[model samples]
Target chain A: MKKLNYGIIIILGIISFIPLLWVFITSFSPGNQVIKGGFPFWVSNPTLENYVKAWETAPFIQYYFNTFVIVFGVLIVQLITITLAAYAFARLNFKGKHVLFILFLLQLMIQPEILLFPNYQVISQLGLVNTKLAVMMPYWASAFGVFLMRQTFKQVPYDLDEASRIDGCKWYQTLWHVYIPSAKPTYIAFALVSVSHHWSNFMWPLIITDSVDSRPLTVGLALFAQSYETGAQWGMVAAGTVMVIMPLVIAFFIFQKQFVSSFMHSGIK
Target chain B: MAAKRKKFGSSSRHNLFAYGLLFPSFIFLTLFTFYPTLKSFQLSFYSGPMTRLQFSGMDQYKEVFSDEIFRKVILNNILFMIGTVPTSLFLAMYLAIWLNKKMAGSSLLRTSFFYPTIIPLIAVANIWLFIYTPQYGLLDNFLHLFGRGDTSWLGNPNTVMIAMIFMIIWKDTGFYMIFYLAGLQNLPRDVYEAAEIEGAKPFQMFRHITFPLLMPTTLFVMIVAITNSFKNVDHLYIMTKGGPDNASNLLLYHIYEAAFTNWDLGKAAVLTVVLIVIMLSITAFNYLYLDRKIHY
Candidate 1:
């Protein structure tokens, strides 16, 4: 049983990582090797030429900067709004709070793709077209983040709230001191999820930004490969693809336990 | 659990504080989600651009329902869901069960299974694009072993949706596996031990014990998968773009072309309403069945 299970695990692992591994190897293999379908499985003559060419061909350094700005930019704003709203829904006793919370949760039901036209209209109306902020605007308020944080805050003991009040801590002070300190795990979980999400978020960014200055890595890489700029050079395409996803991949590797456990925490909750 | 009331007349001030805390999110949600959703619904009935609008009740929707391409898109979406969700769910469940066991190298296996979760979908599509390339593509090369290597996976109408579904399942299964993994780990061990002591077969044990316990997670994952079937169209933009006489055109991608490519907001709005209605009905189904059990 153990050996069979192990065999299944090995096969599954290979299948799961094949695309990533294939892309990585194809990036290092010669362009002709890729065209002849010989490089993905093995790279006998590995080279960095594709990476160099892909970098030279596209302003990937600029794209990396723009992508980070969009990812972290969205992350920071989302943390604030969701934090405040989560705090409100979790702790505050207010009239119509249930209705508001339900309304908030309703956002989760609406696929953002359905809102593409209306959102584009709104973004352009606000004169945010061709801007990085435009790409991040609609997602500035994340229902999932709010839901996660509200659940986290609800688990905090009311004693802390009372004690903070007794210590003359204002609402904001209590939030920063008592609540935030205790919910560190939740915050880390939310941050990791949010960063991963925004880093890889492609569609909205694809719609909103037209130029390299505002295009995130996903958009940049997509355009590089699909828009006929590179014209089906798999090696360069693979290299650009690797460049786009390397940050998240590295982050996951470094925080493997945290990433898995955080996912478990979020899913179970 | 009630604390001492500070001042009875401070109700308004307390309300003020609460609303003040909630202000930013309220504005953002209203602008992005609530308002757009309402406006999308309302605009579904109207015609033309924002500057020159006409009230044509149900006309847009009528056209949407009757259009051949729209029908194809809906059918494609249903087939896409049918193709991707159940297979990925079962695959995820199998992997989750395997990973939950305290076997050697299980942690590595778990991480590898979730490799898809971290990568971007667009990037995945690009990688798969190369793999799906005709003649000399990786898949074609593999198919050569079986002596049938010339299939244009993405080009042909018949295999296009299946090809798209394959990529989606490959990418989406990991996320669902994580959810199932959580559900599996949370199950009580005593019942399983008792079942084992009672001489239950592994398959029978799964059928009688594990599967029932996993119903809630199954329902939740199903909802996630259904919603993702709509949201996940970046691959179409790269891989198919709903091509070969609209064989693989899903609703969202069709709407994208209508609004952006064809520059028809009215039709897009109508399509958006259709999408929202389908999603809402799914939610309504969940509310009626799963939501009650979810909390309890």
Candidate 2:
């Protein structure tokens, strides 16, 4: 039974590994070899030519920059907004709190991504289309962040809150010194989730931005790969795919424990 | 009387402070979410460019409902959901259960499955697109061993949905597996010990004890999966562009085509309304179910 269990898991694991393995292998294989493909297990004459050509083909450096700006822009704004909002919801006895909380929940239900058409209109009217701000703006107030942080903040010892208040700390100061410090794990988890999400976000960015100045790696990769549909440039495409995924995948491997637990933290509570 | 008056005054101060704290989030929520949703609803009732003023009540909705492509798109979304969600759920649960036991190389096994979850869907779509490419693609090359080599998986209408479904199942199963892993960790060990003492078979223990105890996680994960079916159409953009005669078109991608590609804002508005309704209902069901589960 144990052997059978191992056999099943290892087989499934290989199945899981194949696409990634193939992409990695194909990225190094020559164009002729790829064209001569038959179960691309061996790269007899491996080269970095595909990576060079892919880097030269698209302005990936610019894409990396735009992605960084947008991802961090969204995260910084979200951290502030969610922190204050979560504090209010968790600690304050405000009027209409339930109704207001429900309003926030509405964002969770009807995510900004799904409101693409209307959101595009808003960005256009604000004259922010084709800009990183447009990509960053809609996600600034993350309801998911607020919801997750509220759960964390609520668990903070009430005595700490009282003590902070007794020390003549203003509400914001108390939040900074007490609530934020106590909810460090939640902050890390939410930041990981948010950063990874915005890094991977595509459709809305695809619609909103038309220039390389604002297009992230995913959009750039899509445009680059789509052009190769009629041309069998698999090696370059694979290289580009690898480049786009490598950073996050590497970060994930390095912080695999943190990444797994962060995801679990997002879901379980 | 003085103390009572002081309490009342301080409570109002607290209210103001709370509102001050919530002010930033509310501004953004109103702008990008609430207003746009309301705008979509309003636009669905009218039929003209953004500047033109005309009210054609229900005409947009009627047109969208009557449109052939819209029906195909909605049906494709349904089929994609039915295809990916349950299968991924079962696979995820099975993998989680097996890996939960103490075993050598389990960490490696876990990483192999979960790594895909972190990769961007667009990148995933690109990788899978190559895998599904015709003749010289990895899939065909692999199948050449079995004497089946020539197939345009994404180019044929008959096979396109299945092709997209299989790719999605690969991309998402690992993600859903993590949730099941988390759920498995939280299940009481004593119940399983008790079930073993009672001589219950492994399958029986799973069918009764583990599955029943993991009901809340199942429901939560189910909600995430259903919503994902609607939200995640990035693959469609790369794999087929909802092609092979719209065989694999989903609602969100359809809306993208209507709104951006075709610049048919009115039709897109109606589609948006339809999507919003679907999303709202799913989340509503989730909240209601989760609310009930909380009490248990």
Candidate 3:
């Protein structure tokens, strides 16, 4: 029975890796023969020319920089906002707090797509359209982040708050020194989830930003593939794809244990 | 007593400061998120292009109902939800159960499954596009090996939606499986031990013990999965663009094309309102139906 279980797991693992392996192999295959499937696993003349073309065909450096700016900028703002919002919801006593909290939760219910038109209107009205800010604006306040932080904050003891207060530490200090420190795991969890989300976010960024100047990696690759219309140069496409996913993939590998555990912790919570 | 009064004063001030810190995010939510939602509903009454916006008073809504494309988009959304959600949830649950056992390299397997979830959907869509090619793609090659003719998976209107659904399931099941795995890990082992001692069959143990305990996780997963199905536009945008006679055009993709491609923001806003209404109703149903069943 145990051996059978291991056998099943091995099979599932291989099945999961098939697409990934396909992409990895195709990325290195000679440009001319990349699309032929009879030799899916064999790269007759592996070359780095595809990677060079992929890099030259677009300003991938600019794409990466734009994506980095958006992801990190949005994450920093979200961490601050979600922390405070979560604290207020979790610990504070105020009028209509429950009702307001429910209203906040309602954001999760409304699909982000539904808000695209109106959000675009708002961004364009703000004169922020075609800028990285337009891509980052709508995501500044994540309902999920708020909810997660609130749950994490609530798990922290009120005694800590009282003790900090007794020592004459102010509320902000208490939060900064005690709550934030204690909730490090949750913060890490939220960070991983948020960074990954923004890294892969495409549709909103696609709509909000018009040109390559503000375009992120995903949109860059998309436009590349779309323009290569005669036939998708599979080698370049695969190489570009590998470039796009490498950061997150490498991050995942380095912190594989934390990534898995964080999901487990956040999921259970 | 003086110190106590000073402390009380400081506490009130601190509370106000906390509220002040929260004010920006609250304002952001009201303006960008909630306000747009309200504006969408208001704009749903208008007709004509965005620049020529004029209130037509339910004409747009009426048009939405009459529009064949809108109907097809809605039907496609429903079909997508039906096709992807159950398959994803079931596969997740099954995989979670399998991984919960003490097996060698389970963590590695979990990571392998989840790696796809983190990759950009457009990138995956590109790879799958190649894989689905009629002549030289992997699927066709595999079919040839089985003595079957090459199939135009994405090109055919009949198979496009199915192809999209399959890709979605492939990408999402592992993510959902993590949730199920977390839920499984949280379940008390003693209950399972008791069932085992009673010589309960594996099916019986799962049916009686595991499924009941997984209700909350299931509910959460269901809500997320359903909403994701409704909101997913990337795959369609990259792979189909609602092509082959609009076979795979989803509601969200339709809204995107309407607003950006057609420059009909007024109609797009109406579609947005309709999409929100559909999604919120599902959320309400989830809350009404499943929330009560959650153990906590």
List candidate 1 segments past 4 Å from native.
Answer: A1-6, A37-40, A227-232, B1-8, B293-296
- Compared with the true structure, what per-residue lDDT tens digits does model 1 show for residues A24-125? 888888877865654358888899999999999899999999988988898999989998999999988988888888888788888565688888888887
Candidate 1 or 2, higher TM-score? 2
RMSD of 1: 2.6
Query: Judged by TM-score, which candidate is best?
Result: 2
Ranking of all predicted structures according to DockQ, beginning with the best and ending with the worst: 2, 1, 3
Q: TM-score for all predictions? A: 0.96, 0.98, 0.95
DockQ of each: 0.72, 0.86, 0.63
lDDT of 3 at A195: 91
Instruction: Identify the candidate with maximal lDDT.
Output: 2
Tens-place lDDT per residue, model 2, B3-48, is: 9999999999989989998999998898899999999999888887
lDDT by residue (tens digit), candidate 2, A1-269: 86897899899999999989989998998888877755588898899999999999999999999999999999999999999999999988988999999999899899998999999999999999999999999999989999999999999999999998999998789988999998999999999999999999999999999999999999999999998874258899999999999999899999999999999889875
Cα shift from native, residue B84, model 1 (Å): 0.6
- Candidate 3 colliding pairs: none
Residue A232 CA displacement from its true place in model 1, Å: 6.2
Best prediction by DockQ: 2
Tens-digit per-residue lDDT, B29-142, candidate 1: 888888888888888888987898999999888888899889888999999999999999999998888888787788887777787888999998888987888876788878
